[model samples]
Target: MDSLLALLKKKSTGQGSFALENIKCDFFISDFDKPLLYTFAPFGEASADTISWGFEFGKNLDVNVIAISLVSNESWYQDPELYELALNLGKLANFSEILGYGGSMGGFGVSVYSNILKIDRLLLLNPFSTLDPNIIPEETRFRWYQRNLEWDSRFNDGAITCSKGVVVYDPLFKLDALQAKRFKDFKLVKLHGVGHQIPMHLNKLGLLKRLVIDFLNNGSDFAWFYKASRNRRFYPGYFAWMQSQENIHLTQRRKATITKCQHSLKKLISSKPGVDSVTGKDIDFIRDLALDNESKDLMKAKMLMEIALKLRPEGEFLKMKVSSYNKRLDGPDL
Candidate 1:
């Protein structure tokens, strides 16, 4: 962080640069008359050499850029240092407009500070509404950090202050979906099955850069984004994450169930229990693999179908495969 601060100071041509104890802000002046993109760093993204999240993308833009970052992942930008820096930044040479952008934790930062920065428009990807346990006791993903961080009531909910913006998130990610619901007037782009890392998935589809640029330049086109994101069906990472989440949900559901025998949930549960979100192309692929292996390798085919059934708990083809394969496996060796 010290190294990056030194570099920013060397490149800064205006008074829009400040490095406080926890927060650091730097301006990459391009065209003063053009808009300014204020971007915040995501969690665990602090680097000693690099600026922040949107530095590379900002460089290509006609607007000036302000990259803000927390020195560590400790505080969620709820610090006296950031308040002082925002005050200092407000007094700088004005641009034509102000815009903010970030993903995940950085997304939370952008929304929380939008009012203070007077942001005209903003873009957030999988942003948290608040890490305040009292506010969202159901959010159990980041427990350790939530307990440690100061969830100052003053900045508890960004949705209250962030008036207008574009929010992109996966509807399948229940926790993120809950967070996305807190915002009032923002345009919500539901990219299903992409998981919490929507930016990464969009980037994988070669659409992230253009999406940001187009949204920042004009505004979000919901139809176009959805159409473009259909390509994720071919990406294995999408299916992998979907399967992982399904597994988690299945485990949770099993734990929630109680048996009359009072046995452990693990002991009573089916070994090849099904999961809900394992639908679509992944199921087809698994089904095909299981069928192909059934004639060549009975044991392997049964195992493959077991995995398939776990992903698509209600898949009829998988049920047939399970029945057929189990009978074959039970038969005496020839």
Candidate 2:
């Protein structure tokens, strides 16, 4: 598995070039003292995950490489431990600096690596806020990997630790759906109308080269480079159009769920007045929702307290939920 993992990791890093097909990972060791820069790629529909425009960018500027491919896509979710495992591999791989590649789900995941996994710099493409299976509905392009439970997000404020970040959004991002932090925290370059696809933005190499040159040579923010790129190659109307599409698709799903909830209530109501009250049946339904997957989402259970209040209105269950939710809201490890 380690060898296979290494091979896959290589394909993602690309052998220090712009070749997208036979992605192989290796460092362009230019004198042992050269500053190291780690890079990662987005694992989309499994087609272009190996492209290393990021690597090409860095190596061309004469920087060493430490790249990995815990890419974000529907597929890698099949085994999340692997994602974590790939994530942890950076420790073993040697590098003085860090680089994160963005594509599809990789967009946001790479950014978070700053804190969770710890890196220096990252170049993110289209990223997502959360890739949990429970969030996205079936029939969507992302639905396939949702089958694997590991897609659940384990991110927080401290997750992204890069000193400098460069993010590129689909000129037309679907939802703006991903949290703004992916953009707010770094220098962003949004490309519109592009799907979770990669290779469309291979020019991403330029961004990488600039980062290496600044950090390795003079020690700069690389901020000016980011702004200059944005001003010159600006794409208009892409973000607005994506926002419109996102609203429509997301709204459709929300409406469907509300309808389903209405129908299910009919059955719950019809079965009333059955089995003995001693069975403690009525109470548990509300209690269980609070408990079900409570570990993953304490805030949700808290919000549902209002619904639980409606389910039983006033009862011991309501109190229990409120207390549980509040306790969690305070902080974990409590």
Candidates in order, TM-scores: namely 0.68, 0.45
Number of clashes in every candidate structure? 0, 17
Q: Per-candidate RMSD vs. true structure?
A: 13.4, 21.8
Top candidate (lDDT):
1
Position 40, candidate 1: lDDT: 85
Report the C-alpha displacement of residue 124, candidate 1, in angstroms.
Answer: 0.2
TM-score of 1: 0.68
Model 2, total clashes: 17
- Relative to the unseen true structure, what is the C-alpha lDDT of residue 49 in candidate 2, on a scale of 0 to 100? 42
Error of 2 at 291 (Å): 69
